[model samples]
Target: MSIRANLDVVHERIARACLKSGRDPAEVTLVAVSKTFPLERLQAAADQGQMVFGENKAQELDEKATAWTSSDVEWHFIGHLQRNKAPVVARHADVFHALDSVRLARALDRRLEEENRTLRCLVQVNVSGEQSKFGLDPSALAPFLEEVAQFERLRIEGLMTLAAPTDDPEHVRPQFSLLRSLLSTPAPGGNTRLRALSMGMSGDFEVAIEEGATHVRVGSAIFGNRSYQ
Candidate 1:
C-alpha cells in the first residue's frame, strides 16, 4: 500500500483504540518511524501531512533535520543514543525517546548547554527485563530523573519502552501497562510532568495506545518493511 493509505489505516486504528479506551485520539501523537527509509518515502509521508517523524540513528536524523526545514516537522531520536553522538542528536532532535543512562544524559546535557537549548527527553524503561534492550531498570527511574533534573538543558518529558517482541500484542500488554503506571506516578512535588508515554510501534501500536501511549513510533506499517543491509 502507499504511504498515504498506510497512514490512513494507522490513524483509523489509533482512533478505534482510543474509542475502546475512552480516550481522545488527539492525545496520541504518531511518530512515523522513518529510520532506514529513503528521502523520497519520507517526503511522501510528509506530503500527506505527517508532521512528526522518528529516526533511530543520530546521523540519519541530523541529515533529515538539515534537509527538512519545515517548522511543521518534528524530529524524534528514538534509538539507543551514544555519548559520542550526543552533539548531533542534541542539536537536531526536538525530542529524545530513548534516554536510558546518566552518562548519556550528561553528554547530551553538555552539548545542549553549548547550543543554549533544552532537549525534551523520555526515560526508557526495560519493562520486560530484556538483556538485549537498552534501558534503565524500572526501579531506577526516580533516581535517574533526580540526577537528570540537575541538567538544565534536559527536560524529562515522560517515559518510553519497547514491549517484548510477540506475534500476539496481548502477550506484551503488561509491559505497556507498567509504563503507563510509571507515567502516572507523582513526583516528590505531588505533581508529575511525565505526561508523555512514548511506547508502541508499527506492530502493536494499537494495543500500546489503549494502554495509554501518548506517542507511537510506527515504521513498516506505514513505510513498509525496511530494506536492511
Candidate 2:
C-alpha cells in the first residue's frame, strides 16, 4: 500500500480504538517509528503534519535529525542506549525512551548538563522479564527512580515497557496497567514530574490506550515495509 494510504488507515484505526475505549482520539499521540527509513519518507510524513518520529539508533537519529533540521519533527530514542552514545543521543533526541538503568540515566544526565539542555526520559522496565530484553528489573525501580530524580538535566516523564508477544489481551493487560500505575506513584526523590506513558506499537496500541499510553509508536502500520532500512 502507499504511504498515504497506510497513514490514513492507521489514523482511522487509532480513532476507532480510542472511541472503543471511550477516549477522545486527540488524547493519544502517534509516533512514527522511522528507525531505518529514508529522509524522503520522514519529510513526507512531516509535511503531512505528523510531528513525532522515533529512531532506534543514536547515530541514525543524529544523521536524520541533521538531514531534516529544516523540518519540525520531534525525535524519540526508542532503542537500547549505550552510555558512550549518550552524547549524540542527547544532542538529537527530544525524548529518550529506552533509559534502562541508573547508569544510563546518569550518563544521560551528565551529557544533557554539558549541552545545557533538558532531556525528557522514560524509565524502561522489562516488565515481561524476557531474557533478551534491556531494562531495569521491576524490583529495582524505587531506588533507581530516587537517584535519577537528582539529575536536573533529565526530567522523568514516566515508565515504558515491552510486553512479551502474546495474542491474549488479558495476559498483556496487567503489564501495561502496571506501567500506567507507576506514573501516579511518587518517584524516589519526591519528583512527581512523571506524566508520559509511552507504550504499545502496531500490534497492541488499543490495549495500551486502555492501560493509559499517552504515546504509541507505530512503524509498519504507518510507513509500510521500511523501504530505506
Candidates in order have lDDT scores of: 0.89, 0.83
Q: How many Å off is the CA of 20 in candidate 2?
A: 1.6
Compute the lDDT of residue 152 as modeled in candidate 1: 73
**TM-score per candidate, in order?**
0.96, 0.93
- Candidate 1, which segments miss by more than 4 Å at Cα? 186-192
TM-score top scorer: 1
TM-score of 2: 0.93
Candidate 1, clashing residue pairs?
A: none
Candidate 1 displacement at residue 161 in angstroms: 0.3
Instruction: Encode model 2's per-residue lDDT on 6-121: one tens digit a residue.
Output: 88888888888788889888888898999888888887787777889999988999898887767567899999988999999878889888887778878888888889888888
